[model samples]
Target: MMHEILRQSLRWAILVTLITALLSILLHAASATLLRGLPLWGGMVVVLIIILVGVVFDMMGIAAAAARECPFHSMASRKIPGARHSIVIIRKADQFSSFCNDVVGDISGIVSGAAGFAVVVALVVSLDFHEGRWLLETLTIGLISALTVGSKALGKTFSIRFANEIIFRLGKLLFILENRFHIRVFNVKNKKKRKRKRGVLRAPRTD
Candidate 1:
């Protein structure tokens, strides 16, 4: 059992590493292309938007980890669209939280930093202010860092207090994505009995 767990952990680590690298490359390239011709203000706006994405994803990660699965079961009995999805999130909270907090959150942070750099460089070049370039870049990076840290700190507290509600709303969005757009985000299975189920996801564990 220990061996299996070790193997699974290693496997997941490798997979996540590859996924993160590829995603970062794609996102960085896209952001660079988008910022190429945009003005300093426009690039700064894009950077702010990316920071917002990181904050939101961090909130979802913490919320899923803190949410309870029982309440969602009750909602599911009422034929609520998002209730089932919420259960899935709570069941796989560990993985979901890691994905949101580490993968998406980290990617967004990297992209935002690159975007901030672009914005600062554009400002310096546009104003022909070479003398203050270093100082301006330092301030821009500091502001971005402050914003990301401050917002994420606040988000953590808010998400914990309203974990279930946050997960439910996110579940509703996932439900729409799956049903309307035909995306299969989760698989239904019985985590306890190792049996096939329908319309839900199960947490993996050792019995």
Candidate 2:
């Protein structure tokens, strides 16, 4: 459980970092353009600080959403054969699914953020706008790229096909464990009966 929690936290961290970096670049460009008279470095630093704060808030929002959407607490409570015995198994499977989702989300965020930042940087370098105008243009391009990439990644990652694969594998493992336990119990009962029958047969022959 500890390992899983740590892994989830790391995934969130990666996502938050990507978002923060992308936003910071865009915000910096905007601020620089709007406050053109100010020194470039100072404006950027201020924007960076604001972006960092936004990142913290974004992370908190994600954490809250994760808690609310946790499959272990929700789906695992549903009826299944031998529900009591299967609770732990179901919860573990849910955890695995959550971990996979987090990993995919983080990767998607990184890819989108990188693409957005690169586009903005390239545009800013190529264009010959005044300081304020350049910043505005850069921010616009960054935001557009971020949205486009993020939407594409989300669609690809959360498809029905991938979801079914994970669910099917988890269900299969749960069924196998349940069957194995019953088989062992049955074998033990048969062994005891065989011992008793053998003793009775030998003793009766003496009688």
Please give the CA lDDT of all the candidate structures. Answer: 0.91, 0.44
Q: Give the best candidate by lDDT.
A: 1
What lDDT, from 0 to 1, does candidate 2 have?
Answer: 0.44
Per residue, candidate 1 scores C-alpha lDDT tens digits across 1-207 of: 999989988988898899899999998998898899787777888898899999999999999999989998889989798898899999888888988899989999989988998898899988999999999989999999999999999999999999999999999988899989988788644358676778898789989
Which residue pairs does candidate 1 place in steric collision?
Answer: none
TM-score for each predicted model, relative to the true structure: 0.89, 0.29
Q: What C-alpha lDDT, on a 0 to 100 scale, does residue 92 get in candidate 1?
A: 85
